[model samples]
Target: MIDEKGILFVLSGPSGVGKGTVRKSLFDRATDLKYSISMTTRSIREGEKEGTDYFYKTKQEFEDLIKKNRLLEYAEYVGNYYGTPRDYVEETLDHGKDVFLEIEVQGALQVKENFPQGVFIFLFPPSLEELKNRIINRGTESEELVKNRLIAAKTEIEMMDAYDYVVVNDEIETAVQKIQSIVQSEHCKRERVAKQYKKALEADFS
Candidate 1:
């Protein structure tokens, strides 16, 4: 049978919504999938390695890429430019490997416009109260920043309908299973099924 087409899986959610956790779980289940590392002009955090955690670049280098149209989608977030490089994603897809990208709402929209075939998944908190608690529990930001993030989270949650699938992360394992199921089901689409059947019929006739 012919191999299924590669898929671009776009995952997005608000801060403290367990996106990273769910993504790691999904990767563990789907071994062949690859996560696309994004590029940013923001300073690298401690212990972050270039080309692994993120493609760290200077502001001037980032601007040069924008001028050359090398990025798939880019946006300035809190004074730093963050974007996905077009080449790496395209290259991965060409080799029939699924590419997973974790991006913000704006970047996700831009990717949808540019790559209409991409599958968009939005992770949602179980409840607004629970979401607020998750942010507070992290203790990574000041109270003021937490408040701002909560506001942003609400806005992002409201935009869930824009995605193709919505998975509520009440439990980590359940959420990961939902994402895995979505990816597996997509591979069995009618188009892919028909292609396989056609090849089988031709082989038999010949």
Candidate 2:
């Protein structure tokens, strides 16, 4: 049997849009899928690790990587630089492991431009009201921050059409299933299957 090639899966959404939750579920259910850990200049949180959660780096170190063009997509957010490292993602794909990147809208767009074949999915809440409730329910941010996020969510929703697929995460299980189905469908694309068949035919002829 021929080995399968990996794909880059980009997942993007606004804060409190359940992107993290859905991504966790997809990771739990999909063993072959690998999550990309980003590199950030922000201080590590209480329980986060350096390499696992994020490659914690100083401002100078991150700037050096940027200068060397080592990052796939990077941005300075809230006084900290966060970015995805290119080597790890490319290595994972070379090993036939599908890499999933849970990134912001800007990063997702950058990835799409860098890797035209990448699959991009935008997860959205069922409605604005539900999004507000979800943000409040999380209880991690202050009321003012929640309000600001709501405004940002509205703006982000406008970019949904840029993604290849929009998944409304109204229900967790259903949303997870939909994402899984999308991945499965992508693996069946004619281009990928045709490449496999052509390789097999060449081997047989040889």
Candidate 3:
């Protein structure tokens, strides 16, 4: 395997940008990429499993992990704390399995600070008005909450430059294909190929 490291693909976008739908479609058509499950202090919602949805932790426990620096990135959203565990990500990459992290912009930025080698992807809506409509159409949050989210979306969009690739989720299938292409192309990068060449040369001379 030439000690090739797996890609850490972190996905981020504003709320109502259809990131979930696009991520699902992308994974369905791809292989070998594992999802990086996060831990949270939020109450388990209906039908949410402890391990599957999130590693549920109490506020104190979550704080302890933060103090110990065991979390790769942590963010408090709407009173609930969510964080990616450092150990899990490290182990997955050590196994040469790509890990996909679909998170909010705050958490994504934090991840970028800790792991600059990660491939950061940002999902966007076609337009601001379109993003508003998408959120309203969902019928999940109250009117006030929706308004707040729209404001937050603007802020998130401004930070798009932090990401390496921007995917517009106007068409789910098309967005998925674009991200798939990015992943495939990243695998062929010179940094990775050079390592394999070095390993082969060493083996031949040994």
TM-score against native, each model: 0.83, 0.86, 0.86
Candidates' C-alpha lDDT: 0.86, 0.87, 0.89
Question: Candidate 3, after superposition: displacement of residue 44 in Å?
Answer: 6.3
Which pairs clash in model 1?
A: none
- Residues 1-206, candidate 2: write the lDDT tens digits: 66888888898988788988898888888467889989999999999988899999999999998899888899998999999988888988999989889888878888777776888899988998899999999987898998899988888888877799988999989988888888889988998888888898899999
Compute the lDDT for candidate 1: 0.86
Q: Which run of 10 residues does model 2 get worst, by summed lDDT?
A: 25-34
Clashes per candidate, residues 3 or more apart or on different chains:
0, 0, 0
TM-score of 3: 0.86
Whole-structure CA lDDT of model 2: 0.87
Q: Model 3: which ten-residue window has the lowest total lDDT?
A: 23-32
Sorted on lDDT, best first, the list reads 3, 2, 1
Error of 2 at 149 (Å): 2.7
**Model 3 segments more than 4 A misplaced:** 42-51, 77-80, 140-147
Between prediction 1 and prediction 2, the one with superior lDDT is: 2
